[model samples]
Target: MKRINTWLISTWAAIIGYFQFFPQDLNNLWQAMPDDIKASLPPYVAKGVAFALFCAMLIGRSVNTHKEKKVLEQKVEDTKDDAAA
Candidate 1:
């Protein structure tokens, strides 16, 4: 179950990473947008936003994993102490 969960999470991260890193040609999409809106948006704003979001997600995931590891380590230590007692 743990392996399956890890695989799924990794798969999702990879998929999102690809989209954020290598965006598809969206000339048609841009063409569809109104000139005023496109003009208002800052150049490279999408790339900046993507990078910010990716960093935020990775940080959150890292924090969660760190907490889980700490808990597991404490549990192992407690078990060893109990065995010695």
Candidate 2:
């Protein structure tokens, strides 16, 4: 699970970095997309969709990290109780 999370985060970070560093290339790719596909949605709608996806990824990462932290805390508490006994 940790490996999967690391891989996903790295992949997304790379993609974002690529777009940030090479915006013209990204723009070219977007412009090269089929006219009908582009026409199906407004530009702002596409941007919104991208933003929503990024937000979902961030939220998912946060949730997973929280779960792991809680599990670790529970383990520590159990260990302490065992030692005290």
Off by over 4 Å in 2: 44-48
lDDT (tens digit, per residue) of candidate 1 on 1-85: 4566567567756755766565663334555778898899864665566566667766776787889999999999999999999
Error of 2 at 4 (Å): 2.8
Candidate maximizing lDDT:
2
Clashing pairs in 2: none
lDDT of each candidate versus the true structure: 0.70, 0.78
Q: Considering every candidate listed, which one attains the maximal TM-score?
A: 2
lDDT score at residue 1, model 1, on the 0-100 scale: 46
Q: TM-score, each model?
A: 0.58, 0.67
